[model samples]
Structure formats: structure tokens, C-alpha cells
Target: MTSQTLLSHVASILDAAGVKRGAIHDVHTNTHLLRHEVTTNLDATVYRPLFCLILQGAKEVGTSAKLLKVRAGQSLIVSHALPVVSRITEASPDRPYIALVFPLDLDLLRSLAPAVMPTFDKAASDPFSIFRRDMDEGLEDALLRYFVQCKAKNTRHLLAPITAREIHARLLIGRHADVLLRLLWHDSAASRINEATREIQSNLSETIVVGDLAQRIGMSSSAFFEQFKAITGTSPLQYQKDLRLLRARDALRATRAKVSDIALRVGYESSAQFSREYSRKFGKSPRQDRNIAPVEQQQCIADPAPR
Candidate 1:
């Protein structure tokens, strides 16, 4: 509700936690804190299911075809795994950009779906899987309370999960309910697109046959293609390509595997081709990225705490 009070509370916790820039994983709260002292350049990464609450400043995030901006007191929900290009458009030492990312648990949300009354729309008319708007006051209050409760050791374990459940329940009944409820249904376009994304994710190395995929999912190729782009903002092939490159980047950052080997692991037939696409996507060659991988490992991404 009152943005200033909540913002100040979040800022203080981040300050005490020593988050100067980049992202901080709050193990105690199972959330992440991101701060930037100045605006930044265009960056790319894969986003998972999560909601980011912008507490201060602003940022622009988008896929190849869509862009959305978030300022203080706003929130963004990413409902699927997406490769996104983003930039920090607002920040400074005195008023650093701050945001909190909380991962969405589909299983938990699915469980709560039965209790939630259905919306009139079969699926959200808005085809895109991402949503951004002014923060919901009730949701904001619940999150702030969750944060406060995490500070006390006794309640962090005993009561925090209850609040976490409340947070999901609020999402079901809140303004975010439409898109989420769409995903909850087994046969909605959004849900089908979500299934398609998982298939691609599970077999990144295997070549995709769009028609086969469409048939497997019970949709015609033309229909699948159109709905896929509508929901994901990228073509099916492009989605797989982006995901492969992102996974390769993660490998470059965390391992000493040969660049060519890493490329092959991600389904690239030619190491040279992989390098070219990698350079284009990330502005650096594979070896070059590996050279700077150590420092590059930490940033605002879908899953900071990767499995």
C-alpha cells in the first residue's frame, strides 16, 4: 500500500544483509534481493516462474518481441521459462534500484487451484506469459509480513511456510489470478504452451519437429505455432535456441569443460557456429565468457540458487 514505508523496510533488511549490488540469496526467507547503484547495459538471461517486486528505481525487461518496464511499487510475474534481454534504466547511489524475486511453485499453486473459484474467461486474453502492473496492496502486505516473520528465528521455520501458502492463495484471488488460473487448467492455450516449453527444456539436444510436437500435444502445427508465439513471445525454434545458449553460458561460467564440448552438450553441431551465436547473444565468445565466468556467475536471473 504505502510504498515508502514498505520500501524503507525492504531497504533496511537489504542493507543489513550487505547487499550493495547484484543479487543476494536470503536463505532464511527463500527469496532474493537485487540492487544496482547505477543504470546498466542490456543483459540476457533465462527467467523462471517467479514474481519480482520492484522496491526502488526501475528496469526494462523483454523478450525479442515484447518489453515491459517496472518502477518502484510495481511487480512483474514471469509465468514460464523465458530468455529475456533487460537493462536497468534507473538507479543511483542514493536511490539504488532494488527488487525482490520470489520463485513461484507451480505444484503449490496447482494444489490451491481447486479451492479458488474460476474466473469467467477460459484463458486470459492477453497471450503473453508475463504480467506487470502496480503492486497489489493485499499481496504487498502479506509479503512484508512474511519478510518480518523471517527475521525471528522461532517463526521463520514454524510460521513462514503458512505465510508462504497465504501468498499463493492471494495470487489466486488477486489481480494475478487470471493468468495463473489459465495455467491451472489442463487444456488452456497457456497451459499447452507451458507443456511445450517443458518438452523443449527436457530435450534441448534433440531436434524439434514442430508438427510432431503439436500433434503430441493435441494441436495442429499451425495452431501450435501461433499460440506458442502468442504466449512465449518467441517462435518455438528460437525459444530452444535461446535456451541452449543460456545453458551453455551457465556451463562456461561453472565448469572447465572444453568450449566445443560444452557446445555439443547443448546440441550444437558446430563449435564455430555455437561461438558465433553465443557472441551474438551475449556479446562474447565462448572462451571469452569462460575467462570471465567467475565474476559473471552472480546476477539477477531466474534461479540464483540453481539446483
Candidate 2:
């Protein structure tokens, strides 16, 4: 089946199954299903691991210095914890956005990548793991079957994990396999930066000394800095800033605490500095941004919303 045909099929299934389209939180497990229009643009939380595939409509994810646009038939994968800003660029009451996200099972990816003849980008310039396009019919077919099986309450526990493996396996052989492969290895610069990226995430609320992180990763400071940019497309320090701001935003949403208090919690000694950076990243200051709103009401700040 063509990508368009598969997408139409998935949409029909979701509509018939009565998938509730809306912003979801605390709806745990490895995957989520939905149908609806959302407001107050949602920034995807740092997924210790995440895979997002859109069956209808589109969304954009900003990571470091990279902004990836994923639409129907294309998927985005984040192997390491990365701060990302995501928005639904295309959707409506009649034609809503449909997506599936599976958290990374490192053990499974590591186990499978070595045996497969996956493609790797020979060009060292591209540093993202996103498979923005080129999702073939086979991959889409596997995903459709996986999501269908996932909705069965009784079989999910026993079968979801098995199917998740197949999803990753298909991803490895697909067009974006090289980027995913880079994420799994440790010898490459991208892999090293991924390792460093993890360390930053674990201690987002604490002070990060970049030099120490470089040393810990067994690379000299300059070499580490250069390689970090080469792989992730952002400096190590800027990466940390993104992590800190995202954490503060989460806290503000979930609690009634003062903005300054949230700032201090995320390692900003100066509330003014935190607010300044926060405004630059999210396009709203901490105080102004905190005006609580429903998930469906907010739109992304990067690209204008589609009417």
C-alpha cells in the first residue's frame, strides 16, 4: 500500500475505534493514542526515550539547534534524553492529528542493530536521529498493526513489547536507519555526545560543569566541545540550558510555586537570567507563560499555526 493509502486506513480505524483526540498526560505505558484538537502548544517532555509517528497531520520537534518537521508517514526518534519543543502544525475538529510514540528499549535496539545491514549516512554533517521522511509502506504497515494490537487491553501486556521490537527492527532498515544506528554505537562522536547528553539529563536540577563532563567522557575539553556540536548540532552548554528551561516549565505547570522558586530549582541562581532564557526558548517569560491554560488551547511559538 502507498503511504497515502496506509494513512487513510489508519485514520479510518482510529475514527471507528473512537480514539479520543486531545493532549494526554499521565497516560503511561510505552505508547499513547489520541484524536482531537489541542491548544497551548505542548513541548514534549524529555523522553528518557521516545519515538513519534504521525498518521495524519504534522508536528515539529526542536532539539538543540535542530528543528525536525514530521508529518504523516514520517517518524521522529529520540534515543537519548533531549529537551524538545513540539507543536501540532496540522489538525482540526474534522481532520485531527494521529500519533504513536514508543519509548526506546536500548537493550532491544542494541541487540538488533549489530545483526542488520543498516544504512549509515557517510556524510558527517547531519547530526540528528530523526527519520523525517522515507517511511515505506512496510514500516507503516507494521506500525498500523502494532497500534491496533496495542489497543486490545488484554493482549497489550504480553504482545506490545514483542511488536515494539519489530517496529525498531523495521526502523533500522528504513531510510533513517543510519541516524538511528549512530545513536546506538559508542565509538562515534554522535554516540559519545549521546552519552554526555544522558549525564546532563540525570542532573538537570544541579549545576553542570561542562569541563568536568568532558573529562568524565574521556575527551579533552576542546575536543569534547567540538564533537558535541558535530553530533548533536549544539554546544554542550546550550544543550544544558535547554534541559534546565524545560524542567522549570514542567514544574510551573504542575505546581503553584513561585516563578523564582522554580528558577532556583532548575539551577538558575538569578531569576532574571532564567526568565530571559526562558522567554528566548519558549517565546514567553516565566511569569507571563505561567498563566495556566488547557492543553488544547496553546499553539507552538516557532511556526505560525495553520488556519
Candidate 3:
């Protein structure tokens, strides 16, 4: 199918699904429909391992190390959780930017690993955790089927999982196969970095010992630190700090907790320090940000559009 035809199909599904002007969680677990009528400022957020397909317009996403521009007919794959800054570069009411995102199922990917092992070079260098590629017909077909299944209440439960798996399979065998394989392979740089990320996430409020984390993940401290930064585009401590502040921001918006209490809960011992860091990261003090309307705060939290 032509790119425009495929986009038309996706647009129809999005319109029927009534996705609003922001991230709208769809019926399928881990799936979201993102739409925006105007360009957006660069926003920071943790992008979990997922695939994003842009149907119209364009977006820019970047870490401290690299920037990626993903437009229509292109797909962006994030192989690991990473904090990123992104913004919408193109959009309008006439043809607002629309995209679909779904989390990667690592366990499922692992289950399919054995069969696909021979197709990849075992010693290939790891690709960036976040990368973009042109969408292929097979992947597009899988996504189209998945989108259709998402809207079919009766068949969704039965078919969505199957189609989701197929989508991952297509990715594994397609142009991104090298990146996906390295990520899924045990003891690889991507997997080790992913482990470290999980450790930090689980202990967000606690002090993270980078050396201990490195040892636990079977890497020397120096090697682990380098790989962690390579994959995540930030140091281990910085990653943990970002997660803490982001969680604090979420708490500040969702509840009436005091700023100091929220700061303490997120591992910050001093409210004053927390406020300074939060303001620097988000361009607003905790209290000032909390004062914004909830809807506006949510908009601030939306995923950055790919560059």
C-alpha cells in the first residue's frame, strides 16, 4: 500500500477512536494514540522501550548525545528506557501530527530469540537505544492489523496479542533486527544497561551505588559506567536523579502532598535543593508548577515529538 493510503487508514482509526489532542491511552494495554494540533516545546520524559510510527507531520527527539528526526513513513524504535527531550516540529489543524506507540514486550522478544539467532551476527556492535528507520511494508501491515484489532472489541482480546507479537517479529527480522537482537541478547551492552536502569528505577528513593550496580550486572565499574552512558545518554546517578524528580513532579500534580514531603519521598533530603533542581530541569519551581491547571501540567508531561 502507498504511504498516503496507509496514513489514511490510520487516521480513520484514530478519528473513530476519538483520540484527543495529547497522549490518549488506547484499549490495548501499552498502546497510545498521540495527536497534537500545533507544534510543541521540547519536553523531557522517560521513553520506555517502544515503537512509534508517525502517520502525519514530524517530530524531533534527542538525548544529550544525538538528535533524531522522525516524520511520516518513518518509525522510531527505543530499545531501552531513556530520558529524552523532544518537540513537535510540524503540525496544524488541517493535518495534525498523529502517531501510535506501543511498549516492547521483552519477555516475548526473548521467547522468539532462539529462532532468530542465526539471522544476526553475534559480535555486532550495539546500536543506539533510540534510532529511526524507514517503515517497511510488512511492519506496516502488522501495525495496520494491530490498529484494526484494537478497535474491534470482540476480537481485540484474541487477536491483539497475536498481532502484537507479529509486529515484534517483523521488527526483529526487519531493518532494525540488529538493534533489537543486541537489546534482547543476554549479557550484551544493551541488556546490561537495561538491567542497571531497572535497578535505579526500583530503588529510585534510595541511594544508588553505581559500582555495586555494575557488579550485579556483571560489568566492571568503568565498563558499566561507560556502557550505561552510551545506551542511556546520561550517567547512572543522573538517570536516577531524573527519575526521582519526574516522580516528584507526578506526585505534586496528582496529590496535595507538600513539596518538602514529596522531595523527601523522592530521595531528596533538602526541600531547597529539590526546588532548585526541579526548577532547572522543568523551568518552574515545584510550587509554581503545581499551581498550573492539571490539564496544562499533563500537557507538559506528554512525550516529546520526534525531531
Best model number under lDDT: 1
Instruction: Write candidate 2's Cα lDDT for 1-307 as tens digits.
Output: 5555545655555566565555332122345444555422655445445566677778777664677777777776665565555667888876678765555566777889887633555454566544466467777777666655656776577776677788888877876577777777667666777888877766767777879988888888999988777655567778788768867876787788999999998889999899899998877888777865535322221111110
Q: What lDDT does each candidate get?
A: 0.83, 0.66, 0.78
Better of 2 and 3 by lDDT: 3
Ranking by lDDT: 1, 3, 2
Give TM-scores for every candidate, taking all chains together and pairing residue i with residue i. 0.94, 0.79, 0.90
Candidate 3 lDDT tens digits, 73-157: 8988888777788888899999898877767777788889879977776566645788788999888887777766766676688
Candidate 1 residue lDDT tens string, 1-307: 4567667766887788787777777788788788889888877888888888899999998896899998988888888788788888999999999888888888999998888745537835686888887888888988888888888999998888999999989988888887788877888888888898889998999999999999988999999999999888999999999999988988888889999999999999999999999999888888887866322123445463321
Where does the lowest 10-residue lDDT sum fall in candidate 3?
Answer: 298-307
Q: Worst ten-residue run, lDDT, model 2?
A: 298-307
RMSD in Å for candidate 2, one decimal?
Answer: 5.8
